[model samples]
Target: MNTSDDDLLDRAFLALADPARRRIIARLSRGPATVNELAEPFAISKQAVSKHIQVLEQAQLVTRSRDAQRRPVHLDPARLEALTAWIDRYRLVREEQFRNLDAVLSEQAASRGRQTKDPS
Candidate 1:
């Protein structure tokens, strides 16, 4: 990945490191919500929730939209997709490695069975 992609992943992961921020993301994933709504489920102050939202905004994981008199925070699916894609890349590689190992072990077992049957 390029430097910019690395930086974006760094910020996104850092922002998601906080439980509060992650909760906020989870909430927004359902739909857009104002800061007050987002703060309702947490014990933290509204200001604290707003701060978490700010961090998410900085990370480009969320964005705010003007709707009438309310500014609701919305989750950015594109950024989340990017993160998922990055993770899946590594996951796919590991899965392939495991499959290869399984095949090798199965072949070895079959070879051992044939050797035993041959009584050699």
Candidate 2:
């Protein structure tokens, strides 16, 4: 894995640590949203939402663009893929181990069934 990717991943996980930011990401997952649009569902102020967006932007999880006076935010799914990739590595390992265990159990069960069978 790339060293800088690790650093970026750390930044992303840290940013995701905040409930507000995670909510923001969740909102963005549905579609892109303007700052005011993002703030509407929450009790927080637009400025507060902007701060959360800034944190996400720093983590490279969100991107922004001008839509008139609005700074619309969109999810950067590449970072999401990176995060998923990080998690998937361990998930795959665990899955592989489980599959191996399943095979061993299957073999043991088959062996026992064979021994107990009536021979003609």
Candidate 3:
């Protein structure tokens, strides 16, 4: 809810809006990979892959660090957890609303049954 949070979410969603970026995130989910390795599976050039990685980086969804001789891109679970928590909050509210409606319907049905079984 704050502006910063909204901005972060906007960047995260926008970064993931592209198919290539989504695929890159999927690949990173498995494990960390260097730019070259990340680019190998796609038809786009390594530079394009790097650009996608930059977007992901800005979104805080991914981080890159030097490992030995290569820099590997790694998924940031904290950012993902933040996103998941935000989504789950709304999902839980919706689920509770549905449950409340179901209970109301059940009570109405029970009341109708009682009426039907009465003297008349």
Candidate 4:
């Protein structure tokens, strides 16, 4: 089966959904990490961590560099930028909506107070 572009990015977000996976990405932000290094802090098995790595690899969020037997994973800045752009699109709209709602509420409250006071 062929994977679509959306499917690939969706996979990236899903991979990042787990805290452990996010931590792995965070560690990679500093530098590349071997499977063993990534598994060290987590209670899960190396296989489990490897599974998460596999997901990240599929998303292109993490790229494995061939260095002998060690296929250390590195964070892909492009993938992160894609995710940021996707999030920011909706975030800006919601922020604007909240600002508008705040203004509306303030206007309503002020009008209500004016009505409560002596009105000619």
Global lDDT of each model? 0.89, 0.87, 0.90, 0.90
Q: What is the Å distance of residue 21 in model 1 from its true position? A: 1.4
What does candidate 3's lDDT look like per residue over 34-68, in tens digits? Answer: 99999998999999998999889988999989979
Instruction: Report the lDDT tens digits of candidate 4 across residue range 1-120.
Output: 446879977897898899999999899999988999999999999999999999998888988889999998989889889888988999999999999999999988877856556687
Position 52, candidate 1: lDDT:
92
Per-residue CA lDDT of model 1 for 74-111, tens digit only, reads 99989988889999999999999999999999988877
Report the error of model 4 at residue 104, Å: 7.2
- Candidate 1 clash pair list: none
Give the deviation of candidate 1 from the true structure as CA RMSD: 5.3
lDDT of 2 at 62: 92
For model 4, the run of ten residues with the poorest summed lDDT: 111-120
- Give the C-alpha miss distance for residue 31 in model 1, angstroms: 1.4
TM-score: which is higher, 1 or 4? 4
For all predicted structures, in order, the TM-scores are 0.75, 0.72, 0.77, 0.76
lDDT of 4 at 58: 86
The C-alpha stretches of model 4 lying farther than 4 A from their native spots are: 98-120
